[model samples]
Target: MTRPARRIARTAAAGAAVLLALSACSSQGSSAPEASGSSPSSRKLSGTVTVFAAASLKESFTALGRQFERQHPGTRVTFSFGGSDTLAASITAGAPADVFAAASTRTMALVTDREDAAGTPVTFVRNQLEIATLPGNPHKVSSLKDLTRSGLKVVLCDRTVPCGAAAREALDTAGLTLTPASYEQDVKSALTKVELKEADAAVVYRTDVKAAGDKVEGVEFPESATAVNDYPIALLKDAPHTAAAKAFIELVRSPRGLKVLSEAGFLAP
Candidate 1:
């Protein structure tokens, strides 16, 4: 071959090699982000996820919150447990919260109606009312009607809260009514009354009674079936940590979340 032809061929081969190297480098650079970005684990969540939940969900949601924080290394889960109505009011009053888990659909409506909820609330669990009496056969509270006994010092959640509302429904279904000695703001507060022996019996959730363990004895009634409360959860409209909030809610609706809630005596939704 002629020298000029050979030189031209050598230069062209070198140029091709350089272009191939550049192309390979470009491919690696472009694909790296796409590959990593597509992975679920690669989307790490950070910041605090503040959850406002019903008083009845204290135990199960706390377990789920810990699980969420463990799954997301840089994330933290904070909870504010109270009456569903109070939580709903707080959310509507510009409270900064990532999530809201209410004990009843009616209470959840308070938030959704005000446009404080980011999406439609999903019911995760259902709870029923039970008569929580002091340990032993002190009261022998056998039925919902028994709670209406004249001398029984009964406490009830206020008519506004989910637990209170459920109790009211159950009482109404039984065609009976008894004035409570005191009306508490939340289920925990009403349960606390019995736990502390301040009241002979209190109408509270089965879950709360289970949580109370030996502190209070649970007496189930047939009327509870008609008044079961459906617990719903949702993301708030003005969440500070949107990503973390979504992850937390996903964890709550996952299989593990159901397991924890089931163990807490919460029935499936």
Candidate 2:
């Protein structure tokens, strides 16, 4: 071959080698994320997630909220804990909340029926009624009928609240008629009466009694089996932080969330 032709052939081969090297580097750069198990398109959650939950969920939900915040940097979780009925009413009244966790299906319906829930609520846990009394059995209240004894002060949650409704159901199952000293708006309030020694006993949730630790004593009645309440959670239709709210709900339904709730004395659904 001629020297000029040989020089041209060598130059062409060098240029092709350079092009191939550049192409290999570009391919490796594009696949680096996949190789490292990282997602380039995954969204970074930020802002606050406002959760309106039943008072009974305070302990478990608070722990779950902290876990969520840690998993998602720059995100915050704030909670509004109250009676399911009241929280449902607030959600229906256009109260700004990212999520709602109710203690009963009936209360959850109040929000679902009004189209305030973004989707069908999921029942994550169940709770049963228990008689909460003073640290010791000062009244010897061993059974549901014991609360009916004359002069024994007892408190009950209002009929509108899930705990109140469950208490009534338990009473009906036992075929007993006993009036309470006062009807409180929530289970926590009723439990508070017993904790303060103002009432001899109060019909509240097993979870609440457990949460109270030694502050109160819990008595399980057989009738409570018939009055177990299912707890449901949902994302709000008008959630300001839609993505973050959904993520938080996912965490609540996850196994880790269930573990936290189970530790808090809540039964799995």
Candidate 3:
């Protein structure tokens, strides 16, 4: 091989490398340019969106979520329903979630104060505590004052659940205090005790009172007015589906959403 031939081949290789580098940069430019401090290739908002909602929002949210998925086509809305405080703790601990819908403003504050929320939340609904009694109201219990009667077996939500907090406020407003047989973790469980006929009455959310479907009779007391619970919802700071989270939130504040909540006995915020 001649020296000139060897030099010509080396020059050709260098030129080819330059062309490849330019081609790669051009390809990168075709996609959305990454913002400063971000990765070169950004992502699209699609796939699953996880929502951690309060247990009381279960029936209404489950229906709305299906509608949300239908509207978004490829996107899915997955929900984890539980006590709002429990959900908040899970989110703060790095659970993969896109949104948080709480039964109480106090619970929402826990997430927001931690800077876990993306934006200020909006009030979606209001709830008040009610007396959930056995079918047919056998004991003739009518008010928070009635539950204080010694003979009745009563169950109430633990202070951790929003309903319990509201219950305490209602009792305080009425100038009454209650001693329950047990403090259930959530309204559903407390109501379940009534449904199963385990307890004569349980203090649970008004929506839960309705969802019980005649299995329990709801007794609304005047003092519940002072203990109205505001339901707040918001998108998380690290939402995996910000758009969908915003959409779901919009749905909750929409007429359709309000109707679902209202029919379930939630009051307008």
- Compare the candidates by lDDT and give the number of the best one: 2
Per-residue lDDT over 1-269 for candidate 2, one digit per residue giving the tens place of the 0 to 100 score: 99999999999999999999999999989897776764311458999999999999999999999998899899999999999999999999999999999999999999999999998999999998889999987888999999999999999999999999999999998899989899998889999998888988999999999999999999988999999999999989999998899888888888999999998888989
Off-target runs (Cα >4 Å) in candidate 1 are 1-42
Cα displacement (Å) at residue 219, model 1: 0.4
Over 1-269, each residue of candidate 3 has an lDDT whose tens digit, in order, gives 79999999999999999999999999888664444434211223367889999999999999998987777777788899988999999999989898899999999999999999998998989988788999999999988899999989999888987988988888888889789999988778898999999999998888898888989898888898898899999989998777667777877788999998899889999
Highest TM-score, which number? Answer: 1
Better of 1 and 2 by TM-score: 1
Q: What is residue 245's positional error in candidate 2, in angstroms?
A: 0.7
The order by descending lDDT is: 2, 1, 3
Candidate 1, 1-269: lDDT as tens digits: 99999999999999999999999999989988897666332477899999999999999989888888888898999999998899899899999999999999999999999999898899988988888999994878899899888999999999999888888888898999789999999999999998888999999999999998999888999999999989989989999998789878888888988999999999999
Tell me the number of clashing residue pairs for each predicted model: 0, 0, 0
Provide the overall lDDT of each model, using Cα atoms, as 2-decimal numbers: 0.90, 0.92, 0.87
Model 2 weakest lDDT span, ten residues long: 34-43
Count: clashes, candidate 3: 0
Candidate 2, residue 194: the lDDT equals: 86
Task: State TM-scores per candidate.
Answer: 0.86, 0.85, 0.82
